[model samples]
Target: MTILHVSAVKSWGGGENHIETLCYELKQSNPEIKNIVLCVENTLFHERLNETEIEFQTAPLAYNLDLRFSFKIIALCKNKKVDLIHIHDPSAIALTIIADKFASLPPFIFSKKTSFPIKNKKLTLYKYNYYKIKKYLCVSEETRRVTVESIKVKDKVITVYQGTSITNKSSETDFLLRKKFDIDESKKIVGLIGNHIRAKNLETFIETVNIIVNIKKRTDIIFVQIGSFTDRTEDLIAKVHELKLENFIHFIGYIPKASNFIPQFDALLMTSQSEGIPEVIFESFYHKKPVISTNVGGIPEILQDGINGLLTKKQDSAMLSEKIIHLFNNKELAEKFVTISYEKLITNFTASVMAQKTLKEYKNILNGN
Candidate 1:
């Protein structure tokens, strides 16, 4: 079977990472399954794709909703005789919805990533495109629920949790990651990794950091945020400065290798107000580290309330701070949670499992099963 992917970005975001992991696993499972990624040119993720065995197709994607790209994409899909087309983002979905109508379109699959509420225009467009597609995929159950309501989709959306490729055991040397930042080795590092988008809820994470430091008076814990600076980062930086958290919190901008850096933290904290099965959840679990995340999206599906990790109410800094401190003080509990979380990742969320499920989905769609 041949699959062609239409992705709006070549940047190393959660969605791109998921796509790369999926392609890598699919290649490993079945060499005969031809898979290719089509993305806009000249981005770092696009260059990284060059290092992989999966094929690449670069085109000038105007705005994400660019219909002009349909001709180019349709030609590529036809030339490759792609049996399936998986649209990774709304922009690509718009293009596919257009291309399929006028061309010899393959069975199209759309990955529904957005779960947050939206305007009626966006909903209408999604509903229109969704009804025209052969299959729909959601990265999390929350995503499926929110998307169904927003788009009024009656179709059953498949939930495929984002999987990770990391399998290395946490080493004592992992602690040296803080030393690289010139941070004191004795200081505990609490961290979250993502781009500086407002939707990621960076402001709330900063608030949680302040609360944790103030309540514990523990100058020993440093809250570190590693990610690329987005448009909202300036405001976040201003907030940090105003809160006098310059010493307590550090922002390390955009590291290329996510796993190499994120696993170094004592705990991974996700303060996002929204997400669809974040890739970092799997990465942290694989590294045998506990996480404190907001109870949003499909996070609860992967992390049990008190078993695998801790969850805080969305935008609740006080609750988040308490959970972080709880994990820090109770090392044994943290370790147990990490161990269980790792087992969960191995048993349920892995590239191999995702690829197998995806292949089955493809067969089912083709057979109308």
Candidate 2:
């Protein structure tokens, strides 16, 4: 089977990471199934793909409705004899719909990787319900629920949890977080990995840091954020300065293989206001690190409160701070959380399992099941 994966996103984030992971796993498990990626030219996704052996092609997306991108899609589909098209983001859905207008493309398997509600609009509804889309593989159960609300055929939407690849599990890194950031060796490092986007709720991250350091007077913990810096970053930095957390917080912008740093962290912190389940949680599980996240999206599906990890309400800085401190002080509890998380990841959430389930969907779709 030949699959052409589409992603119109410009920056690298969880959705982009999912595509990379899926392709890599599919290649390893089913080599006969050819996977080709079509990403925006010169974008971060394109750059990352260039580093991998994954077969990928790029088209320019200078605007929302760039026919250049559509033309490229047409050429790829015809030349490759593509069996299916997997749309990884909403933008790609629109682009693929446009491409289909000029050419008869393969059936689409759209992956709903976020919990944001589908907008109730004419074009939006039409694009989503487009005839060619065969399956809606959601990242989490919450994502599947949100998608079914707007989808015409509820059966088309199903939850397929995205998992992390554990091919090379190691704590090896060129530099230590403490030495690189000049943090004290005695301080506990709390890591947050996500681009500086509004959905990440970085403002709440800043607020949590403030409450922990300034209000609660905790000098034993440090916050290290690793992700792409965006326009929202300036405001986040300003908030950190305003709260007098310059020394307490470190924004390590856009590190490649950021998950490699997860093993070094005392714990993983996620303050997302929304999610389809961040891949970081799975990575933390593979790294055997305790996680503390806002109870949103598919997170609660995997992270049982006080069982595998701790979950707090979105934007609740006070509660988030308390959880962080609680995890820090309770060593036995942290060990228990990590143990359960690692077992869950190995048993149910590995990339190999994700690929097998996805491959089954592909076969069912092709066999007209």
Candidate 3:
């Protein structure tokens, strides 16, 4: 059976990365499973997909809600004899809702990656149709709950914690990656990996950096900001310059393969307004790295403060800074957190577990079970 994966944007950002990773793992599980990705035309992600063997298609419209693209999706689904359609975003889901009427209905799945406030009537209608649609594959428990409570979707939601394939020991010898970023050999490195956008709480993160620098007075302390931004890169750069955090912070624009460097960080950081369960958190823990994340989304489900990892209030720069500084000051506590996080990842977030659960749901949905 063919599976048609669709998204509104063509960028290989967080959501796109999740889709690619799932498709890769699904293909590995069943080599005969035909998989194809569909996105808007003329985007960088389309070019990036060319690097992989995964087949690709494009819609002739911007990511906006357009009825015309429904016909295009219908024709492609019919031509490919697609048995499953996994729409990755609300916009694409909106298009799919209309397309399903005109096209051969497939087992449609929607993965809600973001917790955006819905105001558009058309989108709300699509959200309401969750029961009528096929399974709702949520990336986090909180996401599934939100669909039930906020979006008013019924019991059709299924939680699939985001999975990462990286698993290896970090060589304490390879400290040169820190040196390359101008970080001191002796100082511990803390990292924040996500878009450099304002909504990601970059300003608060930078403020936290300033506090850490001031309290520690150790120039060896380095903070790494990985991933690129949209709509606010220039402003973020300007703010970094204004804050004069040049020596303390390193902003390495969107890393296509960030796992290669994730091992070097002593700890990982996340400060965002919203999220499903972030894939990076699982990856960091899988790599045996501790985290200092803001309390948001499904983070509470995964992180128990003073246990696995430290969690602070969202946008609270002082608490975030204090936790990082504490992790730096107390090596014993940091090591404990890292130890438990690793155990948790190994037990609950294995890629095989995620895949098997997903396949079971797919089969059940198909069998009308």
Candidate 4:
């Protein structure tokens, strides 16, 4: 079976990371599948593939209506005898819809990664429910439910959780954080690892810190945030400053290989408004760190209250701060939670598991089942 994976996004994030991991696993485990990645030239995904031996081709795409782009993809499919097209993002979906209209194309499989519901618009439905889109590989049950609800196509959607893989790399690279910040042993670091995007709800984390330090009068927890700040970052920083918790709050902009630094965190926190089951939670499991997340999207599916990880109502900083305090107070419970999460990670959230489930879907669709 031959498949052409298309990703035209210039920015790199979890979606791109998942694409790279799935491609790597497919090449290693299913050598006969003839996996090829088609992306924009010199982009992050393209550069990442260069580090591996996986075959990929890069072609520039400027706009959604680029007729030449459609023709190019059609030509590539014909020349390479590509069996199926797996497009990653919305932009790539538009490309495939246009390309399929112009050529005798293979089936298209859409990978849905977000929990956000589809917009109730004609164009949105038409684009997603395109004639050639044979299957939908959703990253979580929440994502699948939304996709089906929005598209009104229930039979085609399937949930497949994103798998996580961590290489036991050295933490020498992360020493720069401790050295640069001059953090001491007395500080208990509670970290939130993600971008400053709206979905991340970083203001909640900052507000939770205020509750812990100012309201609760806790002096030990040092809140550290990784990932790059975006347009909404100023408000978060100003809030932290206004609350006078700046001394305890630290922002370390984007770093490479974040998992290496995750182990240094005493606990992991996710204050997102929405998600399709974040990979960072799985990484924390592998790192043996207790996780605390808001109960939204597929987060509650993996975070079982006090069993494996603590869950709070979305946007409830009081409850979140309480969970944080509880985890710190009950060391044995936190350790047990992390251990249970690690067990779940090995049973359901590994790269091999993800790749195998995805391959099964590919084969089922390819065989016309």
Clashes of each: 1, 0, 0, 0
Question: Across residues 165-207, which tens digit of lDDT does each residue of candidate 4 receive?
Answer: 6443345564655556666887778888888898889988988
TM-score, structure 4 vs. true: 0.92
Given candidate 3, what's the lDDT at residue 40? 77
Q: Candidate 2, which ten residues in sequence have the lowest lDDT sum? A: 168-177
lDDT of 3: 0.76
TM-score against native, each model: 0.92, 0.98, 0.90, 0.92
Candidate 1, residues 1-369, lDDT tens digits: the string is 888888877467888877888888888778888888888777767877887777988877667656657876888887888888888877677777778777868777778765664446955556444655766678888887776665545565667766787533234343356666677878788879888876689989988988877666767888888788878888889988988889888887776665666567888999999888888888888877789999888989999878889998899999998888888888898888989998999899987887788878877877876
Rank candidates, TM-score, best first.
2, 4, 1, 3
- What stretches of model 3 exceed 4 Å from their correct place? 66-69, 117-123, 127-132, 150-153, 166-176, 215-218
Worst 10 residues of 3 by lDDT: 166-175
Candidate 3 lDDT, tens digit per residue, 286-346?
7778899988888888899999889998889889888887888898997898789888887
- Every model: Cα RMSD to truth: 2.5, 0.9, 2.9, 2.1
| lDDT score for residue 238 of model 1 | 93
Where is the poorest 10-residue window by lDDT in model 1? 166-175
Scored by CA lDDT, what does every candidate get? Answer: 0.79, 0.92, 0.76, 0.84
Q: Model 4 lDDT vs. the true structure?
A: 0.84
